[model samples]
Structures are given as C-alpha cells and as structure tokens.
Target: MVPMMMLAAIMSPSAQAQPAAATIESRAREVVALLGGTGDYDATFAPSFRTAVPRARFDAIAAQLQQALGKPTGVAAIEATGPWAAQIRIAYDGGTLNADLTLDPGGSHQIIGLLAKGAEPRGPAAQTLDAVVEQLAAQNGTSVFALARLGDGSPRLEKARNATTPIAIGSAFKLVILAELVRSIEAGERKWSDVVTLDGSALPGGGYAQQPKGTQIALRELAERMISVSDNSATDILLFHLGRAKVEAMLPVVGFTDGGVRNVPFLGALEVFKLKGVDGGALGTRYLAMDAKARRAFLDGPVRDTPIAAIPRDLFQNGKPLRIVELEWFASPNDLIRAMDWLRRHMDGTAGAELRAILSKNPGLPDATKHWRYVGYKGGSEPGVLTMTFLLQAGNGAWYALTAGINDPARDVDTLKFTGLMNRALDLAAPR
Candidate 1:
C-alpha cells in the first residue's frame, strides 16, 4: 500500500481580488463531475494533475481537466501542461477519491509529490517510476512476461516482455485449478468446509502430501495446499473430485484453451499414454532399467510406419496395460497472461485475503523490514522441465504477470538460479 499525503498550502487572498467562491466551487464541482463524478479524484490522479496545473489558472485547468476526466476507465489520460504543473487522473468506482497519483513542477515537470490518495506513502517518486522499470528490464533474463499496475481498476504499465513471442509455461497451470475451485464454491456446487479424504495410494513420488493417506481435509484446504505449498497429493485428490472433464470444460469461460489437467493420476497417466518400449512381462518389477543412450536414441530417431504400442498390459490391476495420457498442464505465454488477467479480476476477497496471509507466513521470506512485495505463484517442475507463473503486487499498487519456462534436458543447472532470474526480471518490470 502506498502512502497518502495532502499538502495544504495556504495562499493569502490577493488585494487585486480573485474569482468568486461560488464560481470556484462551481468549477471544482464541474471538474469533479467531468472526471467521473466526485469519485474520480483518486491517488493515481493527484500527482499528475498537480504537476500539470496551478491553482491560479482555474479556467485553463478546468478545460484540460474535463478532457482528462472524460476518457474511459483504464485509459491513461493524455499528457497536458499548465503554467505550474503536469497532471493525470484515473477515475474508478470505490471508497472516497482514492488514487495512485504523481505531480511535477511546471517549469520542468520536476516531481513534487507521488502518493496514493488514502494510503501510506511508498518511497518511489513519480519521475523515477519509468526509469526504474527500464533499469529492471535491462537486468533480467526470462523470455516472456508482462507488468501491470492496477489503479482504479485499470492496468498501468501493461507491457509484454516480447510483444509477440510465446514461451512454454510449466506448473503455473495450477492457477487454473484454483480458479475452478473458486468458481465451484461461488456457484454453490461445493462449500469451502466440505471435507474430502485423501487416499495415500494416489500420492506421486517426490511431491508434498505423500503421507497420511487417509487424512481428512477440507476441499478449500486442498486447493490452498495445491497452490501455496505446491502439494501434489492434494492436487491429485482435487482433480479426481472435480473430475478432469468438468475442469477442462471451464477453460473457455476463463479465457484459456491450451492449459488444464488432462489426466487423472497425472504421473501414471503420462507413463501409460506415452508407452514406447516397456514390455508386458515387466509387470510388478520395480527395478527395471533401460540404457539412457538407447532411450535417447529411440526418442530422437525417426518414426516407424508400424503401429506403436499404445498401452502396456499387465502393468496394473484388471490385466489392463496403462493407457498413455498427456496432461495439458502447460501453456503458451499469451494464453498464460490471459489466464492470469482473469484470475486477477475474479479472485474474491476471501481467497485473496487468505493467500495474503499464507504468503506472510512463508518461511523463505527475508527478515528485512523494507516491505517485501507480495507475489502469488503456482509453479510446476519435472525432470527436463521448469515452469513458474505469478502475479506480483508491489506495495505501491504496481502489479506484474510473469511466466517463464525452460525445457532444456540438462539436469545439472540450478533450479533456484532460474527462479531467481525470473524474480529479478519481475522486479524490473514492476519495481517497488
């Protein structure tokens, strides 16, 4: 949250006489209405307006003000100048005349004050915001991303890392699950307190929530764990309960097409779906090994005209071989951004507040009091894959949507290093 400061400079009445109080008040009220009623005066508008106009030029200010106020919501006001200042205002429907505003002097548009209308002051001055963003972008390395600042329900600084290129996004697809759960709860399909028991036999290797198989947990708890802690067991159970078909059916409504849980018991499903060389006689053998060289050669070689094995029998109960399945859990950057945008708008107060609480409790956060920014992320990783997607909210109301993915097969590279690089890139896109 940014700080709010209303500077009051008392100017003595001029001996030459000034405009009538009624006229001033009338103009002020008119300006207010033109700018979307009294509510248009938000924190985001103050600094820009203050910088663009001086109190002395009431008529000129009033004319330019009307134009600024007349634009539709989320559309930035065109730059205008008055003898004393430069200003911009964004109107929104909310409490008081809240704003994320900036002001600068008329002579050179030197920053005078940068404050939110009702919140506490954040440190960056208005004049430095753009520079900070540019500096950060120059320092980061992720391939595709976007940064946006929400003020009065509008996104400011909505810039894509590579205007058109799309990158593969990994685990970040879990946000889709979160969205579906919220929608289901909102639609009265389920309750947050509804309890669901976990079947331990369903836990995947190397994932959170692999223990206490029969433990009962609420549906909402599973949703939270799947996202906040990246718990696979909770995710698997939720997927099963929600049903793969039901979840996939909601993607179009959420503005997503290429991402969703494609298979139940994802790991096992993938093994079954992509069966290539596993033999039927290998059933019940937990320790079977195939040469890495041979596997790679087979994977890279040309395809044969003969029908490939689609299922491996004797691998599971019922004498049925596992079916090959591919979970649609990754997405292109464009689709990922659209999905995140939807989440930002649809995230209800309860879920958003809960996530905030969880993030505050995360032990990985640094102890520094400089106000660590809040970022909610859902990530997915596997051997030969790394993916992360997040919505970062700065204390100043600046927000960014970021997605990064690497499919390189080299397992030696550090995952933390990759994640750090993504974070650094986001910091550049939306600085504190």
Candidate 2:
C-alpha cells in the first residue's frame, strides 16, 4: 500500500503557497491535454513532473485514457483550486472524466500530480441478474460469475456461467493468505508486526522485491503488499514463515473444500514459476498422480530446491510458457466469494478494520463506490487469466461480496476490456 503520508502530501494543501486560480487553471488544462495526447509531456511538464513521469509512461497513460474513455472532447474550467492544485471536469467520447493536478513552484510550473477518476457506467439495465451476467459472458466468450447480497444478508443476485469450474486466478489466491493470517493472528499464533527477513527463495515482483536482498520487513507490511499491491515476494515471505501446510489446511477450514474442485496444493509464486521450467505434460502427469502427502513432499523437495535465479525473469516472454489452467493456483468464483465472506466474518474489531483498510488501499473499481459505503478489492492477473474479488458494505449498512474472473487458454485476456466489464457489473448490481 502507498504510505498514508504520501496521499497526505498530495491532498494536504501547502500553507501560503496556493497558486493563483488562473495559474492553476492553465496548468490543469495543459496536463489534461498531455494525458489526452494533444500535448507532448517533455514540452509541457515541469522538470520534476517530467522526471517522475517519463515521456513513455505519459504516452501510455494517454493511450489508456483514449482507449477507455475515447478522445477528450473538452475539459471544463477549474471547479476547485488549492495551493498548487486544481480539479476539472472533462468530457470524453464514451463518458466523463474527473482529473486533479498539482503543479510545481514558479513561472515554469510543471504537473507533479495527475490523477484521473475512472469512467462511470453508462448502459441499459438487463431484466434479470442472470441475463446481465450471461450477456457479458457470451459477449466476452468466457466464463463469468457474480454474486451480490443486500445489506440485510439476503441474496440480491447470484449468477454464473461455468463459475464453479476451477480456473487459474493469479494473485487472487493471496486472499487465502490474508484470511489465514488474520485467523492466525486472532489465535495468537502470529503477530502482524513481527519482523521477518527475505530468504533465498525470494522472487521478483512488486514492493520490497524491488529492493535489495536481506531487507527486514514487518509482517503487517507484508500483508499490506500481498493484498494492496499483490507483491509476489511479500506473499512468499508470508507463506514461508506461516508454513504452506497450515495455509493448505486453512483452505478447507475457510469453506473452500466443499466445491469438489481440487483445492490447490503447495503452490506459491516461486514454486509455480519453477513448475513451468519442466516438461508441461510430464509435470501435469506427475503432479496429478501424487496424493496429498506426496504433493506436499514434492513441493518441499524438487520445487523448493529450484534456484530462484534459474526461474526466468519474464514468465510470459514467448518461449517461457506456463501451464495457466493447470500448473498455477486454481479457484472457482464461488470459492473466491466464500473466501471473502469468510474473511469478513473472521475479521472483527481492529483486526478487521486494519485488513479492510489495507484492501481499500487500492480502490480499483471507482464506479462501485458510488453505491457502496465501503469497498475492499483484491485482483490477480497473469498470462491468460484475470480475477477480481470485492468485499463491500452498502450505504444502508448492507454487506455484499462480488468476484469475477476471465481466462483464455490460447492467449492473454484483454485486461482493459475485462476490467471495464467488471466495473460495469458491480455498477449494475449496486442498487440492490
């Protein structure tokens, strides 16, 4: 999760440093034009802004905005202005966009913060929940599942097209870790603040892995990375320290065993990467033939022994193929929803609030928040797979959980398309 102070820095107005309204307005317009691709980043950005947001990243952001909301038609004059910052309403081809910009000091002011709100849903409602989900599934040509319950704990909607069928759901399996960690903490088995160090098995991903080896980290921070940033190294550190066997046992304990789908056994990011190093068919045959005990031993033996560096840095670089449907983590949409609900029930008081806070660290579905009083999100994606699970509380004090995943065995799923659909699905279910 981003440090709370960083957000504070962005939102906190500087004392006696507020720029004039005219300056804020011009800078806001210029930054929006840069993001809309009509202006060049190098020519328009402040020195610090240019350094922080390179030309390529700026271009990618502009392209994404174009793809997601279409070309920017116009931006309204500044609606709100703060010291070095301004907010504006923008009109796009598909929907409206709200943008906030913070500028540097002096006459050559540059944009230091350029944050954009996600596009809100704009479409006709379907007659039934099933029809809405099914239409999306048919349109995407993939499996889809969605379940939303009212604040009173009554079922508002439940629909699926092959949702129960297990598919690899990248980092969404981290939900199991977060839930189990909460349970362990409640039982006094582990403390969130306990300090731990990286091991040889530490693999590359987000957060601390980007740091040098042997960096000491707090357990609470590890959990934050797992949920908020989906950091792989943080996940492995927790799994290693918590014991994979315990997490394995907790799966069924959390109601994941009832689905009859085989619960994923002894798989972590590092182990999954190593598993891809061997013959795919042989690996499948050998793994499927193993009993539970054998699988555990296998993970502890050959899988654990594989060197971290031996695993390629890029798992998706053409030839380094992974068994997306079989070798990696697997969970049905129903299982994921149950996991979220299980976490909700187990997390209470300060512990619950802390977990939810970490989850809110990434407000992935901006439109969903329009209906929910609070929303917590965790999503996972890898080649050919994308999954998102949400724990939500409605404005009326109703609680609901929603999970959606899409997979294509032949190639990578269109990530932006799936994400847009997921946001739309939540918006459709928000009213109930």
Clashes (candidate 2) = 4
After TM-score superposition, the amount by which residue 229's alpha carbon in candidate 2 deviates from its true location, in angstroms, is: 1.7
Off by over 4 Å in 1: 1-142, 149-158, 162-168, 199-201, 206-214, 258-328, 349-352, 355-373, 409-417
Model 2 ranges off by over 4 Å: 1-92, 95-128, 148-157, 210-214, 258-261, 277-298, 317-322
**Model 1 lDDT, full chain set:** 0.43
lDDT score for residue 221 of model 2 = 90
Give the whole-model CA lDDT for all candidates, comma-separated. 0.43, 0.66
Residue-level lDDT tens digits of model 2 in 1-432: 010101113444544344446666776666667667677666566554554345665576567667777887776546554566555666778766665566664556655556553453345545566665765576443566767563434334465666566777788888888877888888887787888876545564545665665778998998987886567878988887888778877887665653333655757877776677544345445766788789878878876765666664434534222567567777777777777777777657447777778777766654667777888888877667778888888777767888887777776565545656676667766656
lDDT of 1 by residue, 325-395 (tens): 12224455556656666667655554555544433332221111133376665555443345556666667
- The C-alpha TM-scores of every prediction are 0.48, 0.73
